[model samples]
Target: MNIQEYIESGILEQYALGELDDAQRAQVERMATEHPEVQAELEDVQRALNAYGEAHALTPPPGMKERVLANWQAAIQSEPGQAPAAPATEPVVRQLTPPRSEPAAAEIAPSRVSWSMAAAVALLLLSAAANLVFYNKWKQAENDLAVAQNQQASLASTMQAVNKNLTYRNQELAVLRSEQFKTVALLGTPAAPDARARVLYNPTTKAVYLDVRKLPAPPSGKQYQLWALDQGKPVDAGTLAAATVAGDSLQQMKDIASAQAFAMTVENEGGSPTPTLSTMTVLGKM
Candidate 1:
């Protein structure tokens, strides 16, 4: 099988868990030794499982050592050469007794056994609980990683769509540029001598390219309004945003008739019903 297919076959997980039989384990180990990538994947899986196990080890029972010692002592006593007396049902409580004090050892043996058994059961339960918690945490992390990967794929798709749209728009702009387009340079006026703009008007197609690259940004509550002037009176064209100053061109509406000049003024956000003639920034004649 291919490396990717082998990795996906669940054998790696089984190997990590040590669930494979002897022959299968040897085969996996041999493959891992031969393939660095497989080795790395195996190491990662093993490390994760090892960490989970360490975080969930069972604690030995309380007084287990004493109980085992008591049982060993009894076994030794039962032997022919040994002389130590067999401990009683309840071994002496040495924890509360002075070492020098002579007490019946069997008095506390049963209590020790009981305590040891209880502690052993408790430790087993705690180990099980810890294992379950670690398993859940691992599952949750895996789920989160899957979700993030899915989101990344979605974002990549969206970017591809946006790039396609931009390419189409650029093609359309090239077509427009090829037609009967007239370029009009709008000079900065006295009120704002630093601001300038250009209008690329295609009379045949009735399309306008308003390039406002040299224009200053409008105030927060206002935008720049374009007008098509006939004689001395100006006709409303369309509004442009502050983004127009950042080298991004704006496409205005089409079909302007008998326009002798173009002018721009700062007006309210939606633009004024009439041009704010006093705040005019740039003006240009056709």
Candidate 2:
């Protein structure tokens, strides 16, 4: 639909030369009617064709007129007695040769050259149009490939997220359904009324699992630690971050046995040897 490209397309030239088929000619006609530039270009091409034909116009031979006149007089004299008389000898075949003349040879040379020029122009235009078609097709293919790649990447991300969630859920189910594990809840303290955590413990193996369900993320360079109280003394149960992420719930912590209570406290990066009672965010007595 690019007018400039269409204008330079040489379709007008082909139209002037009467080289295009009916459908193509109709299409060019529609274009010419709709676009003034196309119409003007068609007129220009027509004028050029006319100019070429005039410049190379061929004339009849000098003997051609005399020969035709002689034939006509002989026929008239023979036919005077009766109706139009037949020729004494009928011509067997028509002549296909052109008259020999210097002017005619010059005219023929120009005509042949013009034909070659027209053919070359037409061939060049066809090549250009074909290239445009192939270019458009190549661009469409590239766009389709890009869309497919994006869709595939999106599908891959979705699958990865689903698998991660499934893995987390399976781990949770394993701990929840096991008879050897016991569940414990850490209620929010007065210091952090909204904080809460859960613990899963196996008494036989002293394995501990911590899930911080509702707790604020620890400040930079600080972490949360768990302590098990046995005989009124604090024991290092485990350490973990205070933040929770999707597909990540329970964190494995140090094991404990024979604990009377479990508590969580916020401390510096490595954690303290003893519990910071004032910072205790949650506590649950077994």
Candidate 3:
């Protein structure tokens, strides 16, 4: 248990006010016995209560002594058989009609004003404490809301990315299954004996897609580019995206209107207008 949090929870104040049930009082006592800080705080709360009462204690009105003396004399003079005006023994009746005192009134005015001001200050303190507690709760609620909104946004972003990946895979699956597309397997060149890839072509639509089976990681600042051979002349197809080069997925390259052969060669970050024949990695005849 957090001792400071427990102390500030106002349970000690309730205990000081004698508002706790027997079970609650026992619990507080047990805690106080176990924790010296709790015991000290409980003592301070009790002392503050006692001080407030003593500060606000009522003083006897002036001439109280004279009134009591007068009542005592009257009670003694009453006929013995009458029980000495039975109610005369009560001091409350005499106290209600205290004789007006100019000096006493003068002294009481400042005390009354001081007591009223003290009461106002006490009320202000209580109000301030209540506001402080409410403000802390409001701040905690705001923090919790912000955290929840961020988590919800993160979850939404993750779901969108997953859905996009699923859509791309579905399209790739359709292209692989369709009979309209012709598959061309490109065998590795002498430069790279193990490199292999396949190209899918739809002659009617002139569409082209590349699916890499294996490819070496490119050198820094270099990328793989595809070319279409038509009548012994090379036409630039397009460069591969990193995902395609990594064999992560099928990549749709630039459209090819006509071609007798297809090949890949290493180029700069962007493809060159003409292929570097010496850097050719794979070639295939359709």
Candidate 4:
């Protein structure tokens, strides 16, 4: 075989581009090992290809890769006899030589390498696009679920508060409407001239309920206490909560078997064992 003619046949270019079958590639490698000229020519072909790729590098327009990949895939899937005609586009690389009328059947064609590489790139881009779409949909679903859970929690808390308020109001209404309860008037004393309150007593059940009409706010570390005076001696009733002092609603007190009068006094927090006479705010007889 003429070595110079073989070098000029563009066979080295096909070898560099990996367009040769395994048996043909081994034959080329054997030639390069035996002749320093073939080895040097192979290296030159590889360098030229690298330089050409760099010089022709282009930043494609946005979304162009996807469009080209779609078209390429559709063409590949078409039946062999009914393949779509290629669209007019710029040539990727110039042909090394004009086609001959008759060529050796064993020689690899350049078109095979071009089509193989295009198919590989198209499939890769399509896979990447599919993954991105699925990931975005998953994240959106997670965000929607979080928002729904937060709204449900807020609604549950509001309903609980409303139910508790309704129960308190119902109890207050029942006490006011009962016919068995006797109402008592507690007049304000000189210390709190504007302070006034009332007491409801059920004689049969011995239930006592205190209702403040208007009262002065207790000092810090102090609370209002109710006393039942049975025959002039003060009996401990119960201490008032902050809501009761504000006259928000009626408050149930410790039951009293018998009492001639009811009075209110300011005492230390949680109330004292005995009433403090100087702190008396109101007094009323039943």
Candidate 5:
């Protein structure tokens, strides 16, 4: 590549910006050594960038000058792979100040101080930014964990409800299949013609179940109660607590023996010992 043409292609600008990879950097360094023009251009770019950075740097920390001078001196004296108490061009201190026509002590001190201060400020800014990034990441992790726990709880609750329904269905099927139990149908009265229910009972065990099909919502203070009718007398079996029909519509009622007939009545809350004959909604005989 033509050296002048390569310089104008913007690779030097990238070097000044510190954006070049190791290979690109090596090539640029080699070209600069071979061409004095390339060397001068590279120096001028570095000086301009350094000047811009120094101008905008924050105030230096207290006693920074003393520490910087101490560390720098120790570095040159104790550096490895070099002669101890090294012979050099103008002690390391003299090289710290930017080259100027005056080269006065007053001019050099402030320049060196500014360079040290700029480095300290850069380190502080980097530390603060890193802390902020970590804090945000921690908060996001906590939010994700909370969401996962809620989803887990919802899934567990759904599983429990499914298992409960499955158990009820198994018991319901078992009772229906037994030949020892009798099935009775209760038809709605004129008061509630659309209401219908059924009962399955085992005479041997006196276990009874009521199946409510089409019943209106009960009044706020009233409920439905089941009864066993035998020998012209009505005995309280149990109350069907639910006001409206629910899944399967099957609920175990009070168990009794010698029940020749069955009945249902609308009564007060907690049910009454006797059926309210006036509010009877259904009746059936064996």
Candidate 6:
């Protein structure tokens, strides 16, 4: 098969994941040996996957190695024709002896010790590498878990904010339906013909519910300002940020009294001292 077809067959991914059957694995190994490009690509995929696995590895439970070694020794002892098992508390060491007659005294001791030390150092290095790899994998998994937890917390916070807003709006709607309350619909102005708002005023409780759902998002460094107006002169009710624009409803001001009408205008953040007539979006009479 061509390289593209070979890659598209999904065998490479399986090989990287160590899921291939023995026959398929042998074939891939043979091919990798024969083709340098194939070998390079295989190595790249394997390295990437290994890195990912390492990044998400979990620590093995303690005492596992001891358990594994104990089982192995038990199995070895149970084998037919095997030597008798050694005592559990006794230390066992295997010694290698060279033929003594022709060997020089100086060469024998140093060479043997040197070879043994070299073997020990090599084993130590391999063990260290393995331990480092395992540690890195465990740390990576912990970091990933922490990040996932943080994301879940952020989503929960957002949901709580939404729920709180919904509860507040429902309470306002309930008050508006009461006998002592007055409802007023605000029509869109010439500056923004598609926009509209509503005001539910409770005279008994002196609360005003202003819904500015239809208003557009204000420009950067600007905000939507609500005005409680009497005879064209305006009183600052509240200022709304861009986040309030796309939501279903907004509770801009509460506990308002002695206002004849309500109006909205686009103005600087924290609102202007008075409504900017030219930028007015909605107007309503109570």
Using TM-score as the measure, which candidate wins?
A: 3
Model 6 CA lDDT for position 252:
47
What RMSD does each model have against the real structure?
32.6, 26.8, 29.1, 18.4, 24.2, 36.0
Q: Tell me the TM-score of each prediction against the true structure.
A: 0.49, 0.57, 0.61, 0.57, 0.59, 0.45
lDDT of 4 by residue, 186-232 (tens): 99999999999999998899999999999999999999999999999
Instruction: Show the colliding residue pairs in model 4.
Output: none
How does model 2 score by TM-score?
0.57
User: Which consecutive 10 residues in model 3 have the weakest lDDT in total?
Assistant: 93-102
Comparing 4 and 6 on lDDT, the stronger one: 4
The TM-score between candidate 1 and the true structure equals 0.49
Worst 10 residues of 6 by lDDT: 93-102
Model 2 per-residue lDDT tens digits across residues 1-286? 6988997887788788889999999999999899998888889889988999999988878899778766865775577666334564223211232233434675888899999999999999999999999999999999999999999999999999999989977987898788988888998899889888888888898988887778767777877888988899999886785434111578778988778788988888888898888888889877
Residue-level lDDT tens digits of model 1 in 92-194: 5335543333235655788789889999999999999999999999999999999999999999999999998798678548745665778778999998898
Runs in model 2 with CA error above 4 Å? 1-109, 217-221, 245-248
**Candidate 4 residue spans exceeding 4 A from truth:** 1-130
Give one digit per residue, the lDDT tens place, for model 6 in 1-286: 8876786687878888889999999998887898787788889899999899899988778999668766865775588346445655233321232223224454879989999999999999999999999999999999999999999999999999989977987886677567777877888898888888787777777777676658777788888888888676788878764655665565647466668888889998878887888998988897
Clashing pairs in 3: none
**Top-lDDT structure, candidate number:** 3
- lDDT, model 1, position 16: 89
lDDT for each candidate structure: 0.80, 0.81, 0.91, 0.87, 0.83, 0.78
Write candidate 5's Cα lDDT for 68-97 as tens digits.
Answer: 776866775587446444558546634664
